[model samples]
Target chain A: MNFPPPITRLIQHFRGLPGVGPRTATRFVFALLNKSEDELRAFGHTLVDFKHSIRTCKECFNISLQDPCEICSNQKRERTLLCIVARPQDIQAIEETREYNGLYHVLGGVLNPIDGVTPEQLRIKELLTRLEGEQKFQEIILALNLDIEGEATALYLAKLLKSRVPKVTRLARGLPQGADLEYADEVTLINALKGRRDI
Target chain B: MNFPPPITRLIQHFRGLPGVGPRTATRFVFALLNKSEDELRAFGHTLVDFKHSIRTCKECFNISLQDPCEICSNQKRERTLLCIVARPQDIQAIEETREYNGLYHVLGGVLNPIDGVTPEQLRIKELLTRLEGEQKFQEIILALNLDIEGEATALYLAKLLKSRVPKVTRLARGLPQGADLEYADEVTLINALKGRRDI
Candidate 1:
């Protein structure tokens, strides 16, 4: 037999989430069902509030509470060093390292022709406009993923921004921190060897 | 840096779900953020409506749209056969099999003294009351899991239900369909050997 209509509806909504299949969605629904009416209502309100409050930063295309985002609006951040990323969440990952003190530009997603993710679909035009405007960055860092799509996007952006920016660099590819050299893939080993630095 | 306040709140809520870690929770929140405002609002409304409309079945203790539940109220189901399970979700699993036509009794949880899950906390009292009342069942099946706690509960319930009902039966333990005998655990293999039947 099928679940109740309300349960099924909630499950369907949860199934839309990334990596969440029917079973996981069902578990989430049941877990929510166990909560008190007040707690459930609060969760619902939180969801609505999240949607209502969240806005994409017009400058960087990053999702935030404000239009320009806290990073783009901050005066102390290094305007000369611009880091380009694939998505808003990637900015969080870079920020967590606390190593870089620079502005960011979110590309929305990497260029994947098969998936219909073209330059127009992403924020490439916006990035070009921002770079062409008053801001003059000394270096533009393409901090996208190490996948084929990310590489293609990075190459495309690097070529496009070479004339506008002084230097275009990508994040170094090497054996990740705490990763065993024995388990390192052939390409990672080759990259690590090719990009070796003197201590 | 951490996510925005609303995103963090929703992430916290998602993290409270079974098997969902902080990363998975963050992914879920971001996925929700990607949805349109109206769709997100509808999802929020669905959550509230789910909690409001859904109620525990007074007869079987299963979570359902109505008090008695569709199963408890159905006339075609076999009232003479009652199946006892630990959680409400177990009823859905058994119903999916379509092998049994009996009514159900949800015990909420098995008796786990270490975790403070005493008989008092379970629906043991309700089961006893039902058995003692006018609903006479020819066979009471204990369809709990095959783990230590389930075994303990099944044994306890079988003994208690023996005097009340004409017969008290537990689900047959054997090698599961398509399960490799070579990789079978010792306990399961022993059970399979002991419970061997004629073809």
Candidate 2:
């Protein structure tokens, strides 16, 4: 049987979300129906206010309430260091470590020429401006994906920034800390062997 | 790093959904934030209007647009036959088969004494009233779970409705449609052996 217009609409909305399919959407809608009127209204309010309440950092392009973002506004962070990443979520991944006190620049995405995502489409210009400006950045960390597109982008950026900046480094490649040697992929094993360091 | 207030609230709302936790909720919130302004607004509107649009069926207790529900209102459905289910979704499971043309009676849930779900708390009064009232039901199918609670509920209902109703039947226990003999549980294998019929 056909569901009512509102429920069908809600299901469609849920289906539009990443990783949610037809059955999952239906389940989510049913679960929502189980909530009290106040709870439903509260959730609805959150959805409605989400965009207006969250702002992209003008400096880092990280999603936050402030344009400069929490990281960019912090005074104690290293001034002469910058970490470039593909998305805002990657910043969270790095932030959770609490190791890197450097600022960030979200590229929006890696260079995917086939998908029409070029250097102009990314925050490459912004990255250059940040480097050229009064911040006097001494080091840049290109923490990006290992895919063909990511490598190509890294190469392109490295070539451009080599003359502009003193040092440009990529994250290390090796087997994960707890991973077994037998289960390691060929590329990872090769990289791990090639990049061996003194214990 | 802490998320914006709106984003954190949205994540909490997502976490309230079944099987969803902190990481999944955060992922869902990020995904929602990625949606366009119009799409997000439409989704919010759907959520806001959801409860107001869907009404519970007075006859069957199935959540629907109309009080009588689509099935209860349908002229083609068998008026004399009633399939009793533990929940409204169970009716959907049966309906997906496209076999049964009978009406349904959603019990909300089976009796679980430990959870304080007694006969008075359930739709048992409504079920009896339906059976005793103007609509003459020929059969009452106890399509409940096979758990101890469900079994106890079925037993209680069976004893009460045996003399009043013409027939009270339970779903047969056997191997599921696509199950292999080697992997089938002992109870199912035994039930399959016991309930074997002539070819």
Candidate 3:
């Protein structure tokens, strides 16, 4: 059965979202139908105003309401230590730990050759320019994921920045908190043993 | 970290959806951030226009662009055979089967006292009124789910409708088309055996 044009259009928009299929999209449309008119209008206004209200931070390339973003503009953060990440959401994840007090640079994505993501597509040039500018960062931390693409990107950046910067480092890989040794993968076990510290 | 007001509001809207949590809602908001301005505006317009474009069918209580709905207005459908379902989506499901060419009556929901879903909340009155009207239905099929609420609803309706309608029936209870005898539950196996046909 053919849904109404408005419902079909909304379903199509929802279907464009990540991991959402036709059935889920249809369910979303029906759920929306149950909402009050004012709620629907508010949701619509939010979508329309989303892009206008948010802008890419010029200093760090993180999406924010301000040009420099909260972290970049803040005065108390450790300016000499820069943490490089693949996405803005990663910054939030790190912030939740309350361990890192450094600034952040969002690279947008990793070096994914299969999907055609390269150095030119990333903010590598911008990062180099930032490093070369007046700000003298003591260390550059490649806080990327442990996946293949993240590893390749970290390696490429570390090689390019080794001579330019005082120090370049990647996040330590080890068995995660509460992980069982029996179920721990070989690579993680090896990394955990290699990086083990005396208690 | 606190997101921008617009981003947070949009995330809240996505969080209101069924089965979506804070993380998924945040993911949805970020995904929408990547969409083009024009696409975002189109989606916004669709949401705003959703309620205005759709109306509940007065005759069958189905949500549609038309008041009577396409099914109620269609002349080719079998008017004398009516199928009663709990929701409008069930109508679409039955239509996809291509087996039932009869008219439909959407009950809005079944009788669930725990959730405060009483007979007054459902379209039971509307159904009775329609049955008492000039339309002489040969049979009224209670096509509800086999769950507790559905069973209670069907039993209640059967008792109420047995004297009102010429004939009242229900969908056959048996093993599904691809169901295995070994894996089938005891209740389903008993029903399948009891309802066995000559074939």
Whose lDDT is greatest here? 3
**Where is model 3 chain B poorest over a 10-residue stretch in terms of lDDT?**
B1-10
**Cα TM-score per model:** 0.96, 0.89, 0.93
Indicate whether candidate 2 or candidate 3 has the larger lDDT: 3
lDDT of 1 at B138: 97
- Look at candidate 2 and tell me the lDDT of residue B103: 91
TM-score-based ranking: 1, 3, 2
Candidate DockQ values, in order, are 0.74, 0.65, 0.76
For model 3, how does the per-residue alpha-carbon lDDT over B1-199 read when each residue is reduced to its tens digit? Answer: 6787888899999988887889988888889888999999999999999889788999998888998899999999999999999988888888889999999999999999999999999999999999999998899999999999999999999999999889999999999999988999999999988999997
Error of 3 at A29 (Å): 1.0
lDDT of 3: 0.92
lDDT of 2 by residue, A1-199 (tens): 7677788888898888778898888888888888998898888878987888788999999999887888899999998999999988889889888889999999998999899999999999999888888999899999998999989988989999999989999999988999999999999999999999999
Considering every candidate listed, which one attains the maximal TM-score?
1
Tell me how far candidate 3 lies from the true structure as C-alpha RMSD in angstroms: 2.0
Predicted complex 1: CAPRI docking category: medium
lDDT by residue (tens digit), candidate 2, B55-148: 8999999888888899999999999998889887788888988988899998888898889999998899988888889989899888899889
True contacts kept of each: 0.78, 0.72, 0.77
Q: Considering only chain A, what is the TM-score of each predicted structure?
A: 0.96, 0.95, 0.95
Give residue B192's lDDT in candidate 2 (0 to 100): 94
